[model samples]
Target chain A: MRVVLPAGTTETALIDGISAAGASPELMAHTPSADAEILEYGEPTTAPLTPVSPSGCPTPAAITRAVREVVGFDVTVVDAGLTEPTGAATVDLDIDPGTDVRTPTAVPDADAIYDRAHGFGASLPEDDLLIGETVPGGTTTALGVLTALGEPATVSSSLPENPVERKRRVVDEGLAASDLEAGDCDGAPMEAVRAVGDPVQPTVAGITAGALESGAEVTLAGGTQMVAVAALLRHAGVDAALSIATTSFVADAAGDLETTCERLDCELTVTDPGFDRRDHTAMERYCAGEAKEGVAMGGTLSLVPDGKMAALRDRVETVCSRLGIDADGSPKEETGSNTTE
Target chain B: MRVVLPAGTTETALIDGISAAGASPELMAHTPSADAEILEYGEPTTAPLTPVSPSGCPTPAAITRAVREVVGFDVTVVDAGLTEPTGAATVDLDIDPGTDVRTPTAVPDADAIYDRAHGFGASLPEDDLLIGETVPGGTTTALGVLTALGEPATVSSSLPENPVERKRRVVDEGLAASDLEAGDCDGAPMEAVRAVGDPVQPTVAGITAGALESGAEVTLAGGTQMVAVAALLRHAGVDAALSIATTSFVADAAGDLETTCERLDCELTVTDPGFDRRDHTAMERYCAGEAKEGVAMGGTLSLVPDGKMAALRDRVETVCSRLGIDADGSPKEETGSNTTE
Candidate 1:
């Protein structure tokens, strides 16, 4: 199994309460780089940041790393778009970060990035391909893409209590700026991505198409964002069998993942890591519905055996301690409240 | 077999009669890009240029392409250092092109490029990894690296006459500019690459090291340039077994491939494709030693069966005809003398 994470960023993440993918919106750009480094080296050696929720929950990279420590699978990070350079070695696809979704040009090079990623995907060995994504404010773009493709999308947020009105308003502004209405780009999948989708959408969708061509079983390793990719694939007329894997946090969130998967004729696998039964602060925050799912948290969690959850939690705890985060999902070195409260 | 071509460029290729890897000094920078495109698409679409000898002999990319058309192996181009962009999708390692070897910092980011490529190599499946290179004037850099690593060095040239004195002069000037003697960087391999070697060296060496770490059998797919990579690996205290593959043209060149491989404890395979017996201008140019070995021409040629030479020659003839190169490797559309004469 190969975990391919295409990392990017967007200004939409800067909107307060829209995303909790990083310690703050400014730090979100560094999350993908940190995740890549931690997955490869067990810690971030180059970037001074780590992917964390606003409530201090460790990002899914720690979970994936813990699973890798035991399962010994390979991880490859693709730089779909990055505002900053990553210290970790990545397959640089020569893409730039997405602009604000409210702007006319979100991912200006969406088609080109997709074609390039298609070529990259063809080069991989035909194995089980798990494609995850890391783009701050990705769920908002997911909504933008889905609505443009005529799919009514209800996306999950990293913050609890889902900021429904704010997300709808943001997507509405983005649609107006792009001069697109709901279902305007239903038959033109890449156009939706070009107008309002994040770079990770075309990248993950292209890789999936190419990997399918190479006879690899592909699984989108996120929640609502992956549903958007599936929608793109469906609209593009790709008839390959596809699957989506996500955490139960997302399955339980106020999202349209199941119905959308059904409409696209895609499989859905919801893995529950038993976070509610766990005693760690990050786990508690996850249970509280803050930082539900991002990265490949859901797909990677499926790799852990039921008996191995203890080992995985221990690794997660160790990583949190290293980050100076405590059991209540609060920073030990800095004073902050658990935002989920 | 997976062919990983690390494309790069150097001003050393601009030296007269030193490299026939392109139609002219200006076109040399595009040779790797063209080779990558043609290898992926069976023809060049993005760059108008094609890899060709000054004498109009088709570069090794044609042979590799023909073999790939028949065998259907995967081709991946890596942007080790490119002066120009390629139309084909590439695994961008974010490296820049090398300056002239006479400069002190020909490959300033050698160590970092190597480390990044190492990470990439670990991500690949453990199989027989064929690492080829497309760097014009690479043989000169090979000599610089070999001498710096204290290996008794004789490197081949794409030009028929070998331009021995010019290559030696260039290396001497480079050594002086870097304030180093012939054996000054023996124990410190990457230092030599940084000071005088081209970017492809560190990229290939790093990938080889990383692939070896992942339990893959590796073959350096070129003549003198890949030998330089082997030298780098040995000097860095890599104890893994390795092999080198090249065409009989390089084996018969005025070089010390056999002696060097013996000293380095690496296996060498010399493949002869019967270019002398083929009835074609490009094949004749190859037989006359205008373009000896490059772009893994030797390694890919080894994949053809003994009886498939006719089909291979036909494919070569088709490619040459498409390029408007005639029986004598001169332009079919214009008058020019064969440089080998």
Candidate 2:
């Protein structure tokens, strides 16, 4: 399965406690390649920890690298809208770019984005794609779309604990600023996402749905944010051979992801990489629920068996060690293993 | 044959008589799809004539359309660097992107571009590929690359009449600005292209070379600019059973293309899409030495039969007529044929 990470940024990420997708938005905007940032590329050495989820345990960048190492699948990062270039050989899909969801027209070209992205996804010329994403504060837009679609849904967070009220307030604020009313998106998903969702939701949704129309099965490979995409598919009255895969963290989180998938009409699969046994204290964060899920950490992990979890853990450790990042995701004494070093 | 159009702009194209690729530099910056401005994408329909080549005759855009209509193949446009988006599904490859070639460090990441582009080309997953490009001032960069490689070559221009003296001045100025001296690129084609060429040269060179390395039959499908790519492959000691396919205009042009190919060690295939018999006055201009070549018009036209030239002519006329463009490519009365209209 191809790992597709549709990424973006919203000011919602800046609101304290809203997201842990990255150490900070600034860091998220520039992770080089997962392997590059961790192993090669960049320096005078900035961000010793690279970018990690709020939970010190598992970083999306680490897990993404594990997917590349363990599952050995093709990986593609789509810049739906980003603060800066992610130093990777990315497919540029900023046709509509992206914007702050706090405004009424968060994605003014929602329709065009859908069209072009549909073309983009449909044109992938690949088979059995596993589409994932990592946009900071993406869940805020997810909740906004879910609320507007009248889905009675709550999404998981990168925070160890889900921030229901804060997320709700952000959604509420976004809704207040938006022209959408409850159930307005019942038949208008693009408009719903346009008004309040981040750029990646509709883009991934379109790609998934469009590729499905082209008769390819796709895994909406992220957390509850994927619920927004499924909701878009469900509302658009299009049926896709789609399944939802995420981390066991989200599977075990407080969000109503399973029921959300049922109504949205998609399968839900979860994989826990069993980070608890790792020597690093940060690996135990999943057990504590600090960084539940982000990236396609869960879905990508699902491609491998429970047996490969050890390999995944080792991959992360190797990358972190090489980058001088401790298991807890902080700078440590220079390892001198890095090329520039 | 997949049409690949790698595009960028050089300030060299800004000098009067330097390039007629577009009507004016401003108009040149946004040529909807092909190398010429088009009537299809923009609204309130600007540039009634859409920017054509210096000649009042046929456009490479028309030839590309001819290829699409007659040959029917997948087309991919790579944005090596451009002033603005081309209003098409394009691939973006600007690590530093690219600036005017007049600067010493025009393409800062030449090696990376080559590597990434080679990866891109090698990863095509397709068996056969045809890559074309449409940088307005690509030929000037081509000339620079050729000169730097110690090849006494003169490339054809989009302008009906080759801007030899003007292009020579730009190439000399660019060479002077570039740190590379003549023959310095014998084993460093990318460095030469980087120092004196546009983003497209090394990029397509890398793509073509990488695709060939994958044991796939590839066609370097443009005119003189493609020579720069062939040079890159030759100098790199990389061997590929690569062939060149272009239009009669470039084939019959006064340039030493034939001798260049002989010394460069590549088979040259030229197709003469009989533009002389076409009733379209604009197309007849090809007979008059205007708009000689551009886009992948010639190479794409090569994919079909010589007899299809009439059909290709008809396709352009139909597209132009539907877009409210007259046979000469100027705007006629609004046809209400425009989707936006």
Candidate 3:
């Protein structure tokens, strides 16, 4: 019943969900990278910067080492290298040569990333495992993936004070620039990930693969971003029993969730039941029309045994508290941490 | 659009939601009850109080009189009455007549109250009418209704400082006493409401009736409680297109919402896109299944029209500011108001 928590920026939320479930969680941060910068902007701006190494993706070395160090268990990190560099634009648009006049590039490497992420080998232990993600602009990427797949998607930051319009604009622009056609792409799940997916997709795919390989139960953490990752896993021909742990807000936006679950080949579990009671001012502004991607987080986490749950949660909280991130999981906490800690 | 807002204790939330939508609204208070105590509790107590007269159900006379006093127009208040005085308990338990129970009179005349409050006539200026409700312990009733209906209903107060487990217990106890048997009722859309329906049911039923009579679109302004009311209206043979405005949280918990809508025969709208992003510590703690109800209010107001949205939000904010309801929607505001305002 030992749960291994991969350290990511969203530890605050992930940990809270786990700890509240009364599970024992061990927090291990993936090596910090200059590549990923949790950004806080008063206004949306278009600026070109160095593609920081997608350190946001849990490094295989870190994952393996952490598993051995913290959980004292044998674990393997599947290396799914999608982007040439970690810190690429939130979205990568490529023009396929044989496609129409305006075609977007389906990064073959991105497909490889998904494949490798979802392709865990047979050398893994069989136990209940919770898989989570750490990706930058994940919601934006999720929006890109959903839009590329011809589903309306909205990207909202978990930051309390973030402007809804700005987040929506970023997602819309990314999806538009990707040359995604309006028609439904039933197979667009993988394409969406390949076109604009991040490291977390492969990591989650790997976790799914590992679950399949080890015959273990798995839970994907974070919000819509993780759901998109699960979607990518299903599309990659990996059929496994998987669930998501996310806030209630995502569930509301993603109507007809049973259909979505059927399509994704997974169960939907909404965490933070109280989320349904509080006011989400940004719901209409950003998430209303789109199907929610990540609401299954809590229910998924609940599947984890109590001991592991506590460990994962405790570690997450400790790190987040130490980092001075708002334990509530908003990006606002991260803003202060960027320059300070 | 010009919106008329009836002033009540919790009117602030409704007003803010309206004003935020950039609509002009007129606010008027119900004539204060000569002996109205403005009931205040340091902590939510399980003690049942006499049900207040559904006389608060805007009377036709009162509506017309108020319209004349404020807008100088003729208006009607649908009379939805309570069958009996408030039940001795907060929740209505319906066990087998001979079942051994400690709480002898737990099952209140919930259905009778609903029935009594069932005859508010249609709005005269149908297109101009938007109906809303203000019910104390609504989240508890919402939970009861959902649980009775065989849905996994979870309630959480929006009180930041309150303990999650305590809130959940209150809701759970209230729901259990309601004694909702398995399987849907004869004409009920969902079993939850029938098992423990409240005054709001018949009130909104009449509101829907009134709205249809006048050919005006109606908006049910509350969270899960209103949703349940909408459900009850459909069950009572009301045929009208209705829209629901609520916080994203409620929508999230009520998974399979499309089924709920299909059963209820209405459309659902969500306010607060940022609902998921906000750090709802107390709410989430309750969501861990520690508590069944949370003190949530902000999202309830957004159920109104755009014109009324902001005003309702501002009103809530103003009241909270004055009363200091804490970061979460706790009763701190009430305490401050009692002492000062």
Candidate 4:
């Protein structure tokens, strides 16, 4: 199984009102940022992992470690305009580091990145391909893409309490800035992503579409961002042979993900990490809704045997404890956003 | 089709016998050697192309351009270890840049590179995968791998005149430095490559073997070095569904390619570029025996639809004329290997 993490930034996430991803605004602009931590969580030694937002989380890495224990896989990070490198193995797609999504064209080379990403996807072997992504402000980008694709997409949040008003406001401005009406990109999916979507959306969509066309069973691993990708595929008339997999946290979060997936004709697989009872407070934050999901946490968890969540939680606890993170899921030292902005 | 070009260096190429690759030995140590020119040749404009050997030839670019016209594809250069960047879209595999091949271990992380390359291969779609590689002096490394594999392999040279004695001498030293006898690596393919092969060998072998496992038809698109890759596959017991495509220059050169292929259980496809009557004398050098083959020039030409050699030739002439390279296949200025030694 191949996990493609296409990372990008969305200016919508930086709005002072935005905090749904559980990162303190101050830590959001750091080089590795929270988006990169998802890949960082895959390996054990933290020495080479990119320095993520101390206030944010890379929850998906814990889930991926569990899946890896069951069936080993290769991790390939597609540099879809990431602000910083994950320090892992990455394929440079020649995409510029993304600017905030509120630009005239968020992904100017969305077309080229999509074409080359398609070729990359086409080059993989036929198997039960599992694809996952991690873009820090990805949920907001999903909101723009989904709402643009004609879905009432109330995406889940990394925080337990959804920042509905804040996210909705950002999406509203993004939609207005987009030359496209909601359904304008319903026909040409690439256009919507170009207008307001983050770098990860089109890249993941292109790879997913390419793999599907090649006759491989694909699992889109994430929350609303993947739904955004599915929406792009659904409208492009290239939709088939795909499903969405995420955590119960995402499924239970404020988003109407169920209806969104249903509308796109995409299947959903929700894995419960059972964070409610975990002794490790940092991990248990999933139950409290502090760091609900990012990375392919839910999809990766679904791949492992159901009972393996215990082993997975133990690993996370070990990691968190080693890093001196406390039960409240905050870093030992206050690194709130560092945004000096 | 996915084409992976992994490049590296083994100091052995700096020897006087290595001239056919069209690189002045001095420029051979520089970044973006002749290997990169093959991919550059495919594009119509020189802009966006990586600068290769100033004193060398980019003959393969013309051949690859022809193939691109027939079947356009993305070029992914895997930096197995290069002195400098090729400025092309590349995957950094993070293996230590190789020292001279005579080292006790030429590729420090043969196992790691192999594993990662397999993931790269597995990630490709189930199509006719084209796998190519370029490491100056790779033929000597191929000789090392094949002879170590128990094959009495007499490999071809990049020069018009065979550098048999020089290449054989390097292989002899490489073989002796390798702690095992032939078939020592029959059960350990990665070991053979690590001990006696260049950085490109294991990476290409792993990807080829991985793609084969993924049920993709793979074409080892190079000459003797590819033969080395095939030899590694044949011994590893994981072999299936692959072939070697190269130029007649390699086939008809002073090497027993047919017998070697037969010994390794490798199928070969040799394309005749009809270089005999080319106005672009820079390209006709293949006919006269300069720069035999580096990159997948020969194999890429083989993939083009038959009877288009003239169009391919005209395109080459255009590129040659624009580059100011003349009929003598020599640069206007002399850049004899500036050995600071």
Candidate 5:
């Protein structure tokens, strides 16, 4: 099995209190690069540190890294439109980082990115491919894309309390800026991405489409963001049997995920990852609805055999120790629950 | 099976009458990118035209493309150090194009390129890998790398006459400029490349080492250029059994390839692709020793079933027809042969 993570960025993430992918809005630009580095090298080398929320929740890349250690799967990071360069080895799609969705032309070259990524996906030799994303403010872009495609989509957030209204307001502004109403891009999926979505959506959808065409079983390894991708595929007339895998945290937080999957005729697999039972602070954060799923944590966990759960926990412990974090992902010198609640 | 073609460039290709990879020396910088474009899209998109020798011998990328159409193998072009951007989707290693061998710092970051390529190679899920090259003036650089590592290598050429003494003179000047003896970098494979080699050498060797470490069966998939990569792997302390596959034209031109493989305890497979019997002018050029091998033509042909030879021939005819070439690869309106001899 091969796991491909498409890393990008969107200026929508800079909205105050909108994203928790990094410790602050300024640091959010480094989240994708940091996550990719951690996934490939067991720690971040390019960025100064790993991605952590202001409330001390570690990014879900740590969980995916642990699963890879236990399951021995291969990971490849694709630079769809990263704001920072990652120390990890990556496949570059030569895309520019997306502007804020309200700018109207967030991802102007979405179609070209899709076509090139489709060619790349057709070249993979793996029989099974799992795709994930790490785009800050991706959920807003997802909401924007889904609304443009005439779907009412409720997306999950990395913070403890999902900021549903803020996301909807941003999408509305984006729709107004692009001179588009709901369903304006209903049958033109790439147009929706061009107008409002981040670069990750077209890239992931392109890879999935090409992999499916090449007779490979592909799983969209993400949360409601992947639901948006599935909706795009359906609107594009790709009538394939597709599936998505993600954490129960995302599935629970975004109540529309199941109905959206069903409407798109896609299967959904939700795994708990047993983070609630772990003693690690980062793991505890997941149970609290912070840093719930990114970097394919749920999909990677799904691949781990029941017998390897203990091993996976051990690996996670090792990764956390390297980060010098405790239950709240704070430095050992200041260990305490740092949840916003 | 996967075929990885690493493309790069060197100022040595700009020396008067040194390279036949392009129609003229000024065009040599575009050869690597053009070859990659042709291999991926069945034609050149970024480049104004496909690569052709000064004498009008078409590049072997056409052959590789036809073989792919017949056998259905996956191909990936790795941008080791391309001067031009290819329209083809590629994996970029963030390397600079190599300087002339006469410059002591020919490939300044050879080790870093090697390490990164090794990581990329280890992530591949394929069990069988075929590695090729598309560097103009690569055979001369192969001689440079081999000599630096204490090997006497006789490399092949795209021109009919072989130009053996000219290549030797260039390497001699390079050795003198670097202030080193033939065996100065014997125990340091990457050092050999950094001193007087092209970026493609270290990149290919690093990928091969990483792929071998990951327990994949690998075949160096070009002519004497691949022989240089095998030599680097051996000097780097990789003792695993390896193999190389190429065409008989290269074996005949490079009479020492068999002995060098024997010295390195490696297996060699040389196949005759039956190009001599084909009526296409581009196919005839191989018989006359104009464009013997590049872009993994020999390795790809080795994968075809004996029964598929006719289909392969027909496909090659189709590719040649698309290029507007006749018996000597000249324009159909002017069908005179362009052979130097």
Candidate 6:
């Protein structure tokens, strides 16, 4: 079965890891300027899409294109949308779909999107699965997901001086935005996703559950965002095995790796480490968090096998060679679509 | 110790396995034109050095520069000056150094020049080892070296098809021109080096042996040429541990791997597997005996503490990254000097 990853730049590493393991995957890129926020922070604040050149389509459109590229097979596109904060606020929060979203008093439309995306009908394809995600400020979102589920989640950037205070503030703000009470949410993974989770987490959870029911293997083609999604899946009682494809740089980063793996309960695999070696400072700035940390943490718990590292390295090298770019570390003249939308 | 590798178009992958393990290495170009003659049915002729827009230095000079750049230590450059075919007349053979009027026999004098560059005395600062070589169809000289020692050494180009008949004829002709009988020679590895080996190979072996005697760590940096030099060292009973730094491409290639390894009884460490991956076809060429096999067959074994398969893969990725290259089954762009003299 083929899996598709609608990836951002660093996210490409995860897709490479998956593809290296003999799984067919299509990489659909969102235009560099597409400002679909996957994480929400502080008070409910609405941040409009930045008016920059939309280098590509939104995540939904990319998903559609991916489904089309893999012909002659049943396709399943998991909707992993996320909501941005409506206003400037200081706490972190997330929401689970089935329980919190299902309640009559909750945000009805917000919950409805989750139902539509997560509720798999009998008419959908049986063998294919598109594992995806949406986690806003995911390292913080991961913090929330872990805390609400009663794990001691210490989310910090992978920089030399691990910044725990900033992560704590984001997590606290996220918890405030989420509706589920801490006591009620304790020990329930889905409840955590529902309270502080963004749209992508629940959507991926539903997709994994649906795929498991249909007896298809699932390849989670994302970084930390998928980690949050996997947490939701476990909370929802999905018992399917998961394989994660990601870059080696992330896999090698220091973090609460063992905890993340135990929570996800899946194997993790990494592909090329070169991607993590790229300069992502701008990306980290815009994301309001370190991109490397998220990428690395996301790769930790995912199911990735060994041996494909060399193959993936070769593939990246092949592509770079074609572009007349040097592969060993020298900066090249920028020519491709600028990713710094 | 630092090690520098000249970046040749598509040959970086040839030695990546050894470079990644924190070995100090840099890639530079030797010549502007990438010219190497294709050995076919006739005895292969050496292609003229792609005329340097500026004048080109001799092979020994190029080796000297590489050693200085990579190792950052004093260097003893050995020049193995063998111009005349010591045995019989065969096909019109044109190895690069053979075409130059400076002749391979002038290498000892060249060594004196290198010694002068470093200021030698009765008790000089531990002489940076002598790393030597000769270019342009030097494998034929390797055969001559073996023949002069009374060993039935079979040599072919590292090209895809076996150039056995061509190589045999070249060896016969070169041997016929010399006064040394198959068995009537001094056993010093330098004897073969001075008689027939190229300037680079013998010089490097001499430097390596010299360093070992002085109780310094030594590395032979190059391809099949280094392997031949190592074999000579073993024959001389030098006890210093030796390390060979080369691309993985040469190691996986066929030919005198066993004999080279057995002769040296030392380890070979590859810089990057990507190097081997790209040059597989070329490696196959050498394996098929279409060309004479180059150095570092047991090179991996020489890596201190040895590298696991994973370490090898990591090293490949690291080298490729440093070169600003990737591993996608294609030839990378030449970054530095071209060795096609």
Interface RMSD of every candidate?
Answer: 8.3, 10.9, 26.3, 10.3, 7.9, 35.1
Cα error of candidate 1 at position A96, Å: 2.3
Give per-residue CA lDDT, model 2, range A228-288, as digits (tens): 8888888888875579888777778755778778877789997878777776755675677
DockQ for every model comes to 0.06, 0.04, 0.01, 0.08, 0.08, 0.01
Those runs of model 4 whose alpha carbons end farther than 4 Å from true positions after fitting are A19-58, A322-341, B1-341
Number of the top TM-score candidate? 5
RMSD of 3: 26.5
| Per-prediction TM-score | 0.63, 0.58, 0.31, 0.55, 0.65, 0.32
Q: lDDT, candidate 6, residue A298?
A: 31
| Candidate 3, A1-341: lDDT as tens digits | 22222212222212222111121222112121112111101011111121111111111122122122234321112212222121111111121111111124323345554444443322223356655443333455565566566554544343323334544454344445565553244465656655544444544565467556666677665566665666666655667677766545455544555466666777766643221222332122122222122212233334444456445344333333322333343433222111100
Judging by TM-score, tell me the better candidate of 4 and 6.
4
**Every prediction: chain A TM-score:** 0.93, 0.87, 0.53, 0.86, 0.95, 0.54
Least well predicted 10-residue stretch by lDDT in candidate 1 chain B: B332-341
- Ranking according to TM-score, highest score first: 5, 1, 2, 4, 6, 3
Quote the positional error of residue B312 for candidate 4 in Å: 43
What is candidate 4's CA lDDT for residue B278? 67
Q: For residues A1-341, could you state the per-residue lDDT of candidate 6 as single tens digits?
A: 43322112212112222111221211112221122221111000123232111121112222222222222121222223322222111111123222222222222233444454443321133354545432223444555566666655554332323444655554455566665444456546555665554344444555466556766666665545556566666666666787655433344453555457666787665543333433332222222222233311233223222444333334434433322234443324332221110
Worst 10 residues of 3 chain A by lDDT: A37-46
C-alpha RMSD between model 4 and the true structure: 14.8
Comparing 2 and 6 by DockQ, which wins? 2
lDDT of each: 0.79, 0.65, 0.36, 0.64, 0.80, 0.36
Per-residue lDDT tens digits for candidate 1, residues B316-338, read 77766665666666665432222
| Native-referenced DockQ of model 6 | 0.01
Worst 10 residues of 4 chain B by lDDT: B43-52
